[model samples]
Target chain A: MAQQEFDTTAFRNALGSFTTGVTIITATAPDGTPVGLTANSFNSVSLDPPMVLWSLAKTSLSVEAFNEAKHWNVHVLSQEQQDLSNTFASRGENKFAGIDLEEGLSDAPLIPDCSARFQCRNMVTHDGGDHLIYIGEVLNFDQQDLPPLVFQQGQYAMTARKPWEGVELSSEPKAPECSYNEDLLGYLLGRSHFQMLFRMRKVFDEQAHEDSHFFALSVLNIQANLSLEEINDYIEYTGHSLTDTDIEFLISQELIEKLDDETYQLTANGRETSLLHIAQAKAIEEELIRDLGQGDVMALKLLLKRLISKTDPGLPDLWKAKETAK
Target chain B: MAQQEFDTTAFRNALGSFTTGVTIITATAPDGTPVGLTANSFNSVSLDPPMVLWSLAKTSLSVEAFNEAKHWNVHVLSQEQQDLSNTFASRGENKFAGIDLEEGLSDAPLIPDCSARFQCRNMVTHDGGDHLIYIGEVLNFDQQDLPPLVFQQGQYAMTARKPWEGVELSSEPKAPECSYNEDLLGYLLGRSHFQMLFRMRKVFDEQAHEDSHFFALSVLNIQANLSLEEINDYIEYTGHSLTDTDIEFLISQELIEKLDDETYQLTANGRETSLLHIAQAKAIEEELIRDLGQGDVMALKLLLKRLISKTDPGLPDLWKAKETAK
Candidate 1:
């Protein structure tokens, strides 16, 4: 629809549809004060003489300082720096209070642990209606392996990159009428979960442990001194249960021991076994992070957490403070 | 590190660290020919005047047309438009051949189904090193609910928006020594998988079916007339097996019938039940899509498929053409 009438809110929302990486632009005022603010308007301009540009509202409080500055540093924030973005975006004083600044080419304040940093010399300022556009010549730049933070539709985000050619699990397509296909979310989740557990099972198999025993030990690892019934409560959703025979097998292997109160705890050997399991799990995760970038892994975890919360079956919270105290 | 020597490759890679949404800027050449190219160098400049800016390399083939054009349209590409992004980014002739154009305020070719579209009157063009920056005053704009496509470090991506506060399964922190915490990818996947299944179980309960029977029907739905042993082979990874008792149960329920040579095929009733199960699964997915945006769900599925491929344990391919042929 073509609009002759300008609704500011609608215009802003329309602009927000364009996603961007979060950036914090820092500059040193003539008085030697560091001024910074969060802006997603940063964009790369030229390559030969390397240049970039960003826009700021004319009414911004730091506009004067940025205008007078000869140089500024733009920090392409990493996913871990969302708080830093919020801090600089606000009107709070001492924005750099707890920040450990790093030395840069110019006097502009350099923030550490960014996905990338660009030191630029302010080249020109153009007037655009109610904003000032600052074009800068990149003097120096460096990039890290951190996953850049993303912003779209007024929310922080992490990206899961698609391979250039895309990922396909099956070479052949399923029959059109076959409702159960590879695209089914349930099938994907089930297959992914089982495959991961399959990897963990190799480690468990070495100790002559079954999936149920491993689940039991994992529960004890989080909340110790749980009775058999309590342990089953946590592991029941997995469709695996710890039978008396399985508990006896674990005790024979010295992986677990029962107390007088009918509560079971991991023996020292059991704790070590559990730790080894965790190490294997961590190793598997590292391999996945290597295959999929850090950002994709983070996004997967975020989505999984959301899914878990939404479908929670009222099971006892494993990481709850009250549970830990008990 | 400050670089006095500019390596174009390194500079380009460093610049890529700043992620951006893909856009296709289109304008009709002086001879009434449509010219368009994909660009990521776009950013909002002013709100009061509703202005936006994008930069074009001076060496671009379309530079002459863009320079002389008095109006242009900026389309913020949606995730589904990656193919279109690649098409426009190329030097191919007739980029507008298959594209359905929408009527706009100007002669600029407006593409449909973009995350957003900005029809603008050319405002000013500024010089930035080897690039020419074209600023436009937004005469009209519109936005859609589709998720925007993201680009970072030379790859296309989809974003999973983080809530303003963040997602937490529990309010309290786990013990530092607790090896099993919420961040474990395996634990997250397993929990997410089971929790989703638990919701489906409410629907499954109505049919008086357990998960294994559901798995059996799904396998048969994909490849009909599979023997019990073959079906078990397909579903073994899920810790499910089909036994004579299970086969008899299916027969009693008229969900499946024993064919010659001891192979089993889903009866008409069985196929209908399987379709019902798929519908419920799709319903569950729709609710998830509502909670987590479409892009996030798609990304999760992509990642899960990748994970399944990586950790695949030589399970029988259910969707293999040869199997379907049988």
Candidate 2:
């Protein structure tokens, strides 16, 4: 039988939904020539004594260099560093060409204009599918004052603060003029995944037993901008039941409006109703984060990262071993 | 202590370092009227039997309605639904005025045109700082294919794809036309909290010893776009080290250029140098994702979702009890 082929594009697209930053993993070849490649797969391993990890494909040109090199460097890029992300990402390019070079405390060529730079000795390497995972111990580092870059949806992008809350705190003296007066209210009203169980309790709420339409409305509202087919596909994924008549009923009521023949949007009335719930929801989130603190937050982040990586066809075996060990 | 007067701007900005989406949570008052507010602290909870949770201020007018209400609805707004999010989030002024509504399956008025919706019963509420966290058990849900509206930098926006992949897959059918391009690269490239430990590996590459200046150069490149004050702040936060001259040396090299002396961006040459090692770092990511099968993938997502909620402050004790049972 022909080898089972995987749809790389599908995998990429699915993973692309997750956002990450770009970094350059660098090591020296046996002959002392620097070898490196771009990566966004870097993450932290521990805080005490400071440890970090990144991955490298077994078939990559620099694989041998990474395997034998006793030390490595990871450069975190700034928001304005797309050119660097591109240069290192491309294969066979004179990665070092036209770039001025300087050495770090550990003797690696320091990346000019990076958001942050870390120097470390190769701690260990583990086997991941089609790649070798490298862990490092920190020796020294450099820092810069710049917004970090983010990668998502198959492109390099800048991170935006979610309106009123997430902007740089220092910029508060000059808060941007905001007209979206009810921003906080909207957050409280938006329905989230957990609401599924709540809809069930509505059975006890009514004078006459009725199936809750909150989910239905929210589903339709959520699916508003999608085409009918896309909406259906999403409905199928989320396991919602809506007859064509039900959809047409929503349309007739002017709760939803067609953006295009294929796409639809929520009417003004639709948004107000939805916003009512999302506000309360947000207050809950803030409470959780504040209560959890850093330890739980870090654990949560690590577990979530592992979960996302598992979805990809290319997970590391050692990580699996670690999980199994647990 | 005089209520511990706090700088609202400072507190708001400091917390903005974390990113989240905007949402609105709503519930019918005992009188059968609606109440709502906006928030960004919304997240998914249980996937099995789908559940979602959000928080509300304990002192808000909606608190009474929320406490008495047997069920509530959550609406996830789409990017275009910001107006809707705004409407339900506002105070008084008859939110229902000028709003269109469709009766939900449970006879509650459903907001039209949201990204998604969920109807659930109010299962539990917890006391949190200045807020009441409520967890709803989701019984019904809706989803759409539209991009969610993003609130970032005090503006309404849509998510832009991250960089580092090809725009198109094999010219096969069913592929979505990629909306991302280099022109939008500036919007995509930098919003990551790269682990300090991971960054250290890049700082101590063996090559850094060969060229002491390289590490400094890389750090300076990143700093070019940032103010000196900002750089110092970041270093303090991350515990990184560098001297004033190291910064000066980078400026002298012209590799890191300042834009209008207010912000800095890496020169093309600077980017090239930075990319040298980054490409190799991502190879492991590709490999790991490729190795995992679909089952492992699903399990990973579920586990992560559960773990993430565990850290949430808004989760009801009942739901947490259920999670522990698993």
Put down candidate 1 lDDT per residue, A109-210, tens digits, no spaces.
Answer: 999999999999999999988999999999999999999999999899888888898887877855564467899999899999888888888888888878
Q: What CAPRI grade goes to candidate 2?
A: incorrect
Candidate 1 has which clashing residue pairs, if any?
A: none
Tell me each candidate's TM-score: 0.96, 0.31
Q: Comparing to the true complex, what docking class would candidate 1 get?
A: medium
Compose the digit string of candidate 2's lDDT tens values, residues A104-205: 655556677776666778867655445565667656655564555555445554442233332221212331223111111111111112232233233322
Per-residue lDDT of B26-125 in model 2, one digit per residue for the tens? 7777687777666654544343334455666566778898888877776666655666767766775577667687666453346667656666666676
Best model number under DockQ = 1
Error of 2 at A192 (Å): 30
Candidate 2: Cα lDDT at A54? 69
Q: Write the per-residue lDDT of candidate 1 for residues B132-237, one digit (tens) a residue.
A: 9999999999999998989989999888888887888876775564477888999999998988888888877787887899899999988887888888888988
Q: What stretches of model 1 exceed 4 Å from their correct place?
A: A1-3, A174-178, A321-326, B1-3, B323-326
TM-score, B chain, candidate 2? 0.48
